[model samples]
Target: MSGFSSFWASQNKVFRISIILLLLASITYGQGNRKPFAIEGKLNLTSWDIDQNPIELNGDWFFYWNQILTPQDGLLSFNQENKNIKSFPGLWTDYEGDTSYPSFGFASYLLIIEGLEKDKEYALKVPDMYCSYQLWVGSKLVASNGKIGRDAESYEPEWRPVTVNFVAERETESILLNISNFDHSKGGIKNSIVLGPVEHLASQKTNEVAANLIRIIGIALISIISLAGFFLYSKKLFTYFSIFSILWSVRGIFSNMYLIYSWIPDFNWTLGTKIEYLTIYTSVLVGYHIFHNLFPNHSNKIISWASIFINSTFIIITLVSPAVMFTELLNIYFGLMGLLLAYILINVIQAYIYDEKGAGYLAVAITLIIILFFYDMLSYYKFLPYNPYITSIGYVILYGLLGYTLRYNQLHKSKDTTFKFS
Candidate 1:
């Protein structure tokens, strides 16, 4: 076999390598020579060119708060000399240094990038905002995610990355963002913003959206496989895991929700936010069942059932209530999460103390989860500088642990059965 394999490898290796290299070169050359679909701007936009090849638009900008102004406001009787926010990656949260920060109200940012070609095509690439915003390019409203409201029940969170395409109608233009936040723990922009040729940003976003879809679909597959686990092994934990993963994955659909919005143009984003929290609330309920089944001896069945009942009630209420009401319930849900986590930790500790089989591994995983959850929560609260992808990492750890536990239990049960039969 080795002699034949050696001959086969030697026979076509050079030819295969040559073909691959030729194809790669051809592809590279073709892409290099292709003309950009949108009009090209000079390299390096000194402002909000935050990060992009052939440049991004990021830098210092003028900012003001306490009002949700329109492009017309900036045009008619509006002062361009409003106090500078004095940041490259501008966010109203930066102003939180002052105790009087208007975190829950409206703020406007203004920047003008020049050296663009007249009548050429361009698009501003906007990342997720804390709550809502309206993007304006020289008095033209180009894009907005959710309706921006100035106060409590009026504010909503709808964050889907957008590429607002337009003709570079003039060489110099006003890039105005009327941003408001009342949903996130920390309100306002926290990342670099960009503006450039439509094709440059659009192509980059196409790749990003493709990745997001793949992630959602992968989780979707996991949910189906988990559901099938019940029939294969006849364990109730599989059912709980199925629901939990499905709920979490369904919530993730909002991240790439533009796909749905594209098909249903009139679809309101507030509905998406409601459904997001709905899934979140329900997922926590099912998560309790997972623990209840996994550690039936050490878990408190009454508390688990009560959690499910309460969460279910709220979810029903969310379905009927206005989206604003749903937003109001978030703090309560988080408080419940704290209580649930505390209760589960107590149960896990008891399981570990009693020397329950496999409890050690679960304890370790849960401990890591608690740490990461707190870190991520702190980051969310503006108490930390790190914006690491802790949630997804924590989920991966959880799913991996749950999968291993199921497999271990199955294997142990099968061995015991074989021994008894023998």
Candidate 2:
């Protein structure tokens, strides 16, 4: 077979594979649209009508403290030597007989009631408190919040209740509650926490005012900076693109925070919101412009090909996949960015190898930008504790580099003018 024919066959196969993958992703997304079960937030203890049977899980029994665990044979028993009874269902402050907050707090409850049923599903409803809380039914640790459940890690305080099914004893049962305050370092103060029964809300008034304030402040600051840039740079195409990028970024963050839809009641807010797409698109445009600026001559085919492939793949994957796929897609984007950065860095190094002037500083600046990008991605993925704002550090360095390049060009022009006069 001819070499051209072989190349054509290879290209055809690659094209077919790409088409198949796209189709598969689309199909998978479409098929996985089943509605998930809705779990209600925090339970209300008061006015809880027993639909099936009455299984009271609330009763005060005993208290104690122990760092190490030992076998015990009591319906209600814990280390009481650390006698310091704080408050319940909330931040425990103003404990009697204890000057400072106890290192740990544990309490058990025992209740005697005439109406009790067997083989009924019951749950211990604890108010959202400072740290972690554990519950025990008949000496068995039944339910735990912020420690045993997935909802524990999230700080969003919803009225979601934790349910645990228990086997009915021949007689009445004992319920124990153990709560631990993980840290008091940040001046742990008193807060509201209450155990309550479950009830449909009379109103679903989400607390969006605070979120709106944050969004407004963030967006306003970004807008001011963009406007200043327009004034400073004469509204050039690059400046405008950068402004749009930042506007989109602000919008994306705000929308993700649900500030836009929440504050603007008239606006139709959908469950599956893709408002962040605008931000992603604007970012790509800015990146494209940056690439053009970095490689003005467009002399390297490999760099151009690789960048196009990576960016095109990112755009397609992001558009087709749902938000849940963001974790996986973000990894792809991060990898692409890393490779593109390394490619640029290699070119910078090559420039220096050729004894090129001003290449050293450029190399350092590029390295810094790459490092910042990696750190920002890590932080975004929750792998690092660094601030998300770290990504903008690269933008600062980029602006400084552009200014230095412009000033150097002007100086070089002056040298040429002097030579001509001479």
Candidate 3:
């Protein structure tokens, strides 16, 4: 266990990156002008009605591969790419072209949106984008997010949504966006972008920030609760569960991309991600340890050692690999989860059938967890739209059940001695 703790301590170097992905919406085509290779999406400004809803900026935009430079970096390169266009709200890696997939470097997207009211305030909500990006409306640079490195060694992914508000200086605007992503497999705007009134954008930002704060506070409370149990019980199950709770609380802190990026704007998202995944893996390790302790007969030393070995190897691989490769192994994590749940289910049922104290609550808890795990797995595979962090919720219940079981066992032993002596 000491060695295991030391291994986790060594993973302090890991960081993570990802940003708030705005929901995808449909686009309505309207009158707009276009240039060769530039997307001419309709940025309708006719309606100021609060109920009018936002307009989705969709169409093919200029796409450059493995090159993140200033707009003037290529005096001749910009003009020559008249036919090179990639659709908006899609990754360049998925775009069909002469260029190969997974182009690992810098890229730029150029969109020319014409027909806008002069001197009117407008806001463009950037969707969850991979790696980093810089937005230039006309000749003025409006915003930049995360660290944009020229190459792999310099590249660290940190994701955050940014709202760019600008007054229409002219009736026509050419938006030049320089983006770079070496973190994930496909990189670009994965979510739909909204463009509309500045007020609406501000309201949206406020809601996002509020949600993040609430989530962090709630997770912090859970950690505190579990910590109290750990200290009061001084049992292995309670200690492991406490560690798991704290890890999840840490995950919640970094879960909201927008707030985190705001606080640590320049901090490496990759490092954050490493910490995130490390917590996840570590939780599972300690989780199995708790199970093995509670049901020692069902899981022996061999089973214990195997679980440790497998997770330890995965953690090492995760620390060394890029985000793209690591994501591919997520299914494996799911599979291991399924195995653990099956084992726990069997043992929990056996305990219940034998009339063990607190086994009933433990049974109910594990059953609910299995159901939540199923739903979360579906959400993970895009089978469901709701991204329920059920694991966190499930663990909270499990921790409480274990606490009850520990106390119940102690009372059961005390009652037996009293009966025998009488």
The candidate that achieves the highest TM-score relative to the unseen native structure: 3
| lDDT (tens digit, per residue) of candidate 1 on 181-274 | 7655456677666666777778767765665565566566777888887788776566767787777777766654355555454566667767
TM-score of 2: 0.36
Q: On TM-score, who's better, 1 or 3? A: 3
Q: Could you tell me the lDDT of residue 212 within candidate 2? A: 35
Better of 1 and 3 by lDDT: 1
Q: All models: lDDT? A: 0.66, 0.42, 0.64
Residues 1-422, candidate 2: write the lDDT tens digits: 69977876778677879778668756655543321211121122223344422222222223333321212333313333433333332233444454544423433322222223455444443333333455555556765544422232422111122334555453345444544443321111222222212231101012223333444455445445555654554434335444544554455443433444334533422221334543554455455444444334432655655565666666665566643354235656667666666666677677667744455666666677667767766544334543323443444545456434333332333232111100
TM of each candidate vs. truth? 0.63, 0.36, 0.67
Q: Of 2 and 3, which scores higher on lDDT? A: 3
Candidate 3: list runs displaced more than 4 Å: 1-52, 55-59, 67-82, 95-98, 114-117, 147-149, 152-157, 182-186, 258-260, 294-305, 320-422
Candidates by lDDT, descending order: 1, 3, 2
Task: Give the per-residue lDDT of model 3 (tens digit) for 32-146.
Answer: 1221222343243343332245555667666666666564653335567364666786876677756765746678776656667778788888865776788777767877776
